[model samples]
Target: MSASQAPSQPVPPSWKDLGKAASDILGKDYPIHGSTLEVKTHTPSGVTFRVFGLHDNKSSAITGDLEASWFDRKKGISLTQAWSTANVLRNQIELQNHLAKGLKFELISTLVPEKQAKNALLATTYKAPGLHIRNFVDVFKGPLLTSDAVVGRDGLLLGAETAYDAREKKVARYNLALGFYAPDYAVALHALGNLTTYSASYYHRVNADVEASARATYDSKASSNVNLEVGTKTYLDNAAFVKAKVNNSGILALGYAQALRPGVKATFGLALDTLKLSSGSADASAHKIGASLTFEA
Candidate 1:
C-alpha cells in the first residue's frame, strides 16, 4: 500500500508578513507618493517652523493644517491638550497679469489627547479613458490599523490632503488635513450619521468633551485623461481615551473626498481620507473645525 502523505498545514496570513511580501513586490507605493513641505512661520513669535505638505488629489484628500498646541493651565485634571484654527481661501487672482484656474480653499483641524484615531486614505480621481483597464490599490499602516484598497478598473487615482506641524521633517507634532471630492461625501455621511456619538477614534485622534469637526472640498477638470491625480500622506502617533480609562483619543476629524469628471465618463468621484484629532483647551474640550471642499455632484 502506498503511504499517504500528510496534508500540509495552511499558513495563516499575517498582516505584517503579507505587508512585507506586498512591499517586496509592490515597493512602498502608498506612503511615498510624493509629499511636499512648506514653510509657514508665525512672524509674530519669530519662530520659524515648517509644515509637511499635501498632494493635489481630490477623492482621497481630507483636512489640512491641523496642529496641536499645549495648554499649561488645566481646570481639574492635569490635562495637556491644545488646538488652533486657520481660515484658508485660495483664489486664482493673477501672477504677472495672467489668468490661473487653480482656485482652492480648505479648513482642517486636529489634536491628540486620549489617542485612538488612525487610518490613511490613498488613490483618487485617477484614470486613463483612452488606455482603459486601469487598477489602483492602497494599503495603510498606523495606530488604529486600517487598510485601504482601491481597485480602479480604468487607471489609478491618487490623493493627499495633509497638514503636518513638525519641528522636524521626520516627526510631525500635529498632522491634519481635509479633502472633498465627488465620491467621499456620501460615505462620510453614512459613517458619521449612524453612530451614537458618530465620532469614532482609533489610535490617538479622538473626540473628548466638546469634540466636533468637519471638512469639505471641490475639484474641476484638472486632468486630460479624466483628471487623474497622484499623491501621498502620513499620520502621527496617537494617545486617546475611550470609555472608563479605556485609553483613547482626545480629538477627532471625520469626513471624505470625491471626484466628478464633467461630461466625459460617468463622472465617478472616489473618496478616502484620514481621522485625526484637535484639542480645545487644557481641559473641558476635545475637538473642533468643520470643513469640506470642491464644487459639483
Candidate 2:
C-alpha cells in the first residue's frame, strides 16, 4: 500500500500515565496497617454504589460513593454524577463530549458541604496518530492552568507537563519524561519537582504469570539521598497471586491475594524491618500487618 494509504500508528497514553505500568505493580493493594472492607454494586440503570470501611487499632471509619451516568451513544456525549462521603461529604457533576474527530471536551464541578460550587475544572484532550495532548484549567479557584503532551512513534515516547499559576502570573511546575513502551516491557525516566528530583522505573512481564518492577529516585537537593525499590508479582494459579518487595532502607513487604469466589476477593499484607531483624531486636511493633476484603457485583 502507498504511504498515504497506510494505517497510522496508535497514539501514546497521556503524560500522567507514562510510568503507570511500573507504578501500578509497585503501589497497589499493599496497605501498611488496618483492615479494609469494600463493596461495590451496579444496577442495570447505569448506577453504581460503592462502600468502603477501614478498621484499625486506633479508629474505624466508613465511606461510600454513588455514581450515575447518562450517555448518548450516537452523539458521543456523557453526563455523570457522583456523590462521595469520606472525610468530607462532596458531590461532583461532570459532562464530556467529543468536539471533533480527535478532540474531546470535559467539564467538572464539585460541591462541598457548605459551598454550593466549591470548584470547577475544564479539560480538553486531543489524540492523533502518534500524539496526545491534554489541557486543564481550574476556573473556580486561582484559575490555575496545566497542559500535557506526549508523542510516540515505534515504541519510543517523549512527554512533558507544566502547570501555570494564572493569578500569580508565573509558572508553577514542570516535568519532563522519556519512555519506551513495548508489548512485554516498559521503562520510563522522569525529571520532576522542577528538576529537583529524578526517578526511573522499569516493568517487565517475564511470562504469562510473572511480572517484575523496579523504581529508584534521587533528590538533587539532598546529600547522597537515593532510594531504590524492587518488587515482583507471581500468580500461583488462576485464583491466587503473591507479591514481594524490598527497599534499600531494609524494609521488606509481602502481599498475598486470593479469589474467594466469583465476586469476592481477599488480600493480606505484611511488612517487616529487616535491619531490626538482623540485629535480633525486632519486636511485634516493628512489623506491620494488614488485610482487605472486596466484594463486587
Candidate 3:
C-alpha cells in the first residue's frame, strides 16, 4: 500500500471512559452549593504547585498539592494535603512511572488518618491499537482487585469491568458497555450495578460553537426510579462559554466560564429547583450559588 493509503491507527479509550463524552457535556463544570478558588503554578524544572480553598454557609477548607515530573513527564510524584477548620487533616501521595511502550504503573498511599488499613493501592494500565486495559489492587487489607478492558474497531467499542473482594471471597460488582464514537457524535450504553441499572447517553456537536448531550438511566430493582438529563454548551467567543442543564426532578443548573487573562479564569454557577419556584415556595436557601477562580502558569 502507498504511504497515503495506509490505514489510520486505532486509539480506543478505557472502559471506564466509555460515556465520558456525554458525561463531560452533560455533567461537568456545573457546580453545586459552594464557592471554590484554585491557583496553580508550574516551573521550568517540571515542578508544579496548587492550592485550593472552598467555602460554604457552614464550613471552609483549604488544600494544597505539589508534583514533580522527570523523564519527559513519564515519571512523576505528587502529594496532596488538605485541612478543614473542623481540625481534620488528610494527606495522600502518588507515584507514577511508564514501564514500557504501552504499560504504566501507579502507587497511591494515604498517610494521614492512619486508622484505615486499606490506605494503599496499586494500579497499572496498558494501551495499544484498538485495545485498553486497567487493573487496580489494594495493597493492604482484603487486597480487593478490579479490572477493566475495552476493545474498539471501526469506531465501535465493547467493554467490561469487574471487581472482586478477596476477603469476602466473592465478586463484588460487574458491568458491561457498548459505544460508538464518531467525529461529530457519540453514543454509549451501559449495564451497571451488577446489571440492575441501565443507562444510555448521546453526545453531538451541533456546530463549531455548540454542543449538546443527553443521558437517561433506569433501575430494574426499582421500577419507579428513572432519571433523565439534557444539557447544552455554547461558546460565546474564544474566551467565554456557557452551559445549562435540567434533570427529571425539575432541577435546573447554569454555568458560565470566562478567561480573564493569559493564566486566569473564572466560573460562576447557579442551581434552582423549578418545582419549588413554580409553587412560590422557593427561598434563598432553596437555591444554590457557587463561583470558582482558577489561575495557572
For candidate 2, lDDT tens digit of each residue in 1-297? 998998788989899899898997888878667788888787776566677767763355555565556655566666766767643443444334545677888887777765554777888888888999999999976689999999999889999999999899999999999999999999999999998899999999999999999999998988577899999999999999999999999889999999999999999999998878855666777788889999999
Question: TM-score, each model?
Answer: 0.16, 0.89, 0.88
For every candidate, C-alpha RMSD to the true structure in Å: 24.6, 2.5, 3.2
Off by over 4 Å in 2: 56-89, 93-97, 114-117, 278-280
**Candidate 1 global CA lDDT score:** 0.23
The TM-score obtained by model 3 is 0.88
Candidate 2 global lDDT: 0.84
Compared with the true structure, what per-residue lDDT tens digits does model 3 show for residues 1-297?
A: 997897865879998789898999887777665777887877776656666667763454443343333323545555555554433454555555544667777666654444433367788888888889999997675778999999998999999999999999999999999999999999999999999999999999999999999999999988867799999999999999999999999989999999999889999999998878855666666678888889998
List per-prediction Cα lDDT, in the order shown: 0.23, 0.84, 0.81
C-alpha lDDT of candidate 3 relative to the true structure: 0.81
